[model samples]
Target: MNWNDLERLFSPARLGRYSAARAGDTTKAALDYTYNLQLSEAMMPMLNVLEIALRNGIHTRLSALYGREDWWETWVADTNFNWQNKEVAYAKAKLNRRHEPQTPDKIIAELTFGFWSSLFNTQFQHVLWKDLRLVFTRCPKHQRKRHNISSALNQIRDLRNRVFHHEPLLWLTPTLIQQHSVGVMVINWLEPDLAVWLNTQDRLPTKWAEWNITSD
Candidate 1:
């Protein structure tokens, strides 16, 4: 089922009840709730980034290359999957160093992964790898393993979708906030120089040098 379907299946009050039953103590429950909120927030930047990129026409290349017909259109006009935020338009306009004009596809890919570059190293790296795995591997929907990016993205999307659909967040998981190493690799592939930029951001670990991704 789509993310919206999942949201209606579980409600927040029902989630609270579930948590009340499963949590061992007040501290544990509080931590769980906080983690869920943090994860939801963390997932926003990427969605914002994607929407910005798409709106700006930055993702034209990948979308064209992949033969995307209506995925993007479906997204923008989607009532159930509203990924837009005002910052996205600003982000797109501000993409080029001097606001140089860019094609839609390039804009999307650059910003899609560029947002990855802006994330806290831990979450960014993991989500990047998760996307890579999803894109690279050939997995059927029936046997999808622990796909990391979707887990996090889906987690965030599902939460938002639930709220939009007038349902509560019942199935949120707390311990799923950590990165999956995909972000690091995707940054390296999409923007070779991102390694150095990440260094400047102070989000990546020192050992990140071992990856040998070029900034130029």
Candidate 2:
């Protein structure tokens, strides 16, 4: 699409009139670069932490509860939990296609973030939450409600999809910051030492200041 068309598509009202008014500047290339850089830098660290923490957290809990790291295989074998059947099937297919032995670590790594997040879904909440909550030790301490973990995960998943899909994020700075905090908090909840190291590695604050995005 042409510059004008691209601007119209991406420069939504959420980005403010300043962005929309400057849509033609530099033929939209500069703006696109800025948006991509800002969003990518802001989301990268959290994405890394979220994926690792989610996988490890779930693996630990399930392994303990089910008495094996390969609990996912047995969990999927049960026909009763039909709600998760499709996700489990997809995970199995991913593992099979890899031609690698289906270890719990491999399967957990292969499973999509959506699959892990879905553990909090109301359908499986009753069956899964009892065991799952034990892994998220800090969630109850901070949120005081078990459901908040799912809510945060859902929000992070949405933001992740948008960022990865090259969608506009300029308009979502506030939400992005909020969700980024959620990511850090959840990471800390999962592993304190890792979170401490992640704080040192985080680039969001520096990038935010570089972009001069007002916290208002």
TM-score between model 2 and native: 0.80
Best by TM-score: 2
Worst 10 residues of 2 by lDDT: 12-21
Position 78, candidate 1: lDDT: 40
129-166, model 1: which lDDT tens digit per residue?
34433432333445343443344444444444543443
Candidates' RMSD to native: 14.8, 4.2
Model 1 residue runs over 4 Å out of place are 1-14, 17-24, 46-180, 195-216
Model 2, which residues run further than 4 Å from truth? Answer: 1-29, 77-80, 140-142, 213-216
Candidate 2, 49-143: lDDT as tens digits: 87887878888888898897777667665765665667767777887887777776676777788878888877667788888888777655657
| Whole-model Cα lDDT of every candidate shown, in order | 0.39, 0.72
Q: Residue 74 in candidate 1 has what lDDT?
A: 31
Candidate 2 global CA lDDT score: 0.72
